[model samples]
Target: MTTVSEAILSRRSIRSFLDKPVPPDLISKIITQAARAPSGGNLQPWYVDIVTEDSHKRLLDLIQTKIASNPTGETKHYDFYPSDLPDKYTNRRRATGAGLYEAMGIAYDDKEARWDAMKLNWAFFGAPVGLFFSIDKFMGKNQWCHLGMLMQNISLLAIENGLATCMQEAWAVYSDTMHEFLNLPEERIFYCGMALGYEDKNAPVNKFITKRENITEFVSFID
Candidate 1:
């Protein structure tokens, strides 16, 4: 059995998945377990819309159509990053992106290739299951933090079950289209999407692992 630390360390944002199907029952079990994640005042602000089989195909089709008609992408409902990212954040982001492109053998100047690679997010990176997370627009930042806890729980649980997951915030760019397709209530705004399934072990993109700052970089202990 995998220990908690082992599971956490092994989890990665898998970008490529195999054609293998994940049983709905297993997905249900993982999410149910993840529901144990704590929420402020037990509000449980997170809601997930699971997509699989035909529904998955339909969502992907619509996303492709929208992308083709509007290649520039849609406006995000929330700011995923600051308007002017601090040097620390920007440097890390650039480094991670560069590492991924390098792993995939994509040239730094290859805009077309980069865009094509990014489009794969809508395709769920060929995962058998996709999940859309949402929260009420009225929720505060604390609620959003709770949602993050829930997602982290799901990711860790997935790793324990021999499944891989990728949390795709890029989906927020197509929030309107997804909301319409998923028939989500107006009050519930999209937060992010997740791809879940067995990893495509042979994929070059899967080999890329981003660097993480040491604990000392972001942690402090006072005696």
Candidate 2:
């Protein structure tokens, strides 16, 4: 049995995946365990819709059509990032992106390659299973934070089960398409989605590893 600490350390945002299918039984276990993640007041404002292969193909086709028309992804009801992020946040985002692109031998000025890579988000990065997470429109900031915890738990659980996943905020670009296909209720709004499956060992994109700041950078002691 894998320990929690082990899962935390091993988990990474795997960008490459095998075409193999993930067994339903293991998928069930990971999600069931992830549901144990704590939520504020136990509100558990989260709904994960495991996509079927047929639906996956349909969504892929929709994304392809959109990309052909507009290389940039769609806009969302809520902003994905701050209009003006502080230096600390901005630097981190840049560093992670640069590292990932560099791993793929894509120069900073390579617009074509960059756009192609961005399209992978719509393709679920080749993962066989895609998960769409939704929450009620009435949910507050606290519930939103809870949803993040749920996402992290699910990602970590996949690691423990020898599976890889990428929690994709990029999927929000297809929110309307996703909502209609998932038949989401009127009150529910799409938060984000994820791609789940076996990692493709040979993909260069998976080699990117962004650095993390030391504990002192953000941690403080009350004493």
Candidate 3:
């Protein structure tokens, strides 16, 4: 039998995708099955919005037009990382970013090329479908963690079904815009987004493999 670990190991944060389409039914199946992910008190304080068809094109067009003049995008306070983030975490982030740029043949000093690459996040990396995740603003940290499990579940299920996904926290910066665009209520907070589709095997950026810390660095055992 194919093990869950097999699916987990095969999954990658795909950056570039082919121009093919993913069937809506498959998308439905993935979302439905991901519900098996557990939550505290089963609060299920998460919400996801799928964008495709005409809506997806409209969203890209809107963002492209907005970015043409205001490249900085809508400004807001984002706490994705801690203000006093330690060097250990920051160093890892820097290394991963450097590796990604290296894989794409982009120099560390090539600011324009790097921006071009980061801008692809808003483009869903050319995936056929984009998914936005949100949580109730009233929820606490535990609920946020629960929402994350939902995201992880969806990614693994995608892998099991021959698709790839990128969980994009970059979208947190555009939560206001996305909220207005999606007509969501003020009681909820748009958290992040995801790009879903088949992987582009030939894309250099998609081939970059991020390094993971050894289990010994995080795991603790007692006698």
RMSD in order of candidates: 0.9, 1.3, 1.2
What does candidate 1's lDDT look like per residue over 36-95, in tens digits? 999989999999999999999989889999999987768779988899998999999999
* Clashing residue pairs found in predicted model 3: none
CA-lDDT, candidates in order: 0.93, 0.87, 0.89
Badly placed stretches (over 4 Å) of model 1 are none
In candidate 2, position 30 carries an lDDT of 90
lDDT, residue 59, model 3: 94
Candidate of highest lDDT: 1
* TM of each candidate vs. truth: 0.98, 0.95, 0.96
lDDT of 3 by residue, 86-147 (tens): 89999998999999999999998899999999999999999989999988888998999988
Q: Per TM-score, what order, best first?
A: 1, 3, 2
What TM-score number comes out for model 2? Answer: 0.95
| Candidate 3 Cα lDDT to native | 0.89
Residue 192 CA displacement from its true place in model 1, Å: 0.7
Of candidates 3 and 1, the better by lDDT: 1
Q: State the local distance difference test value for candidate 2.
A: 0.87
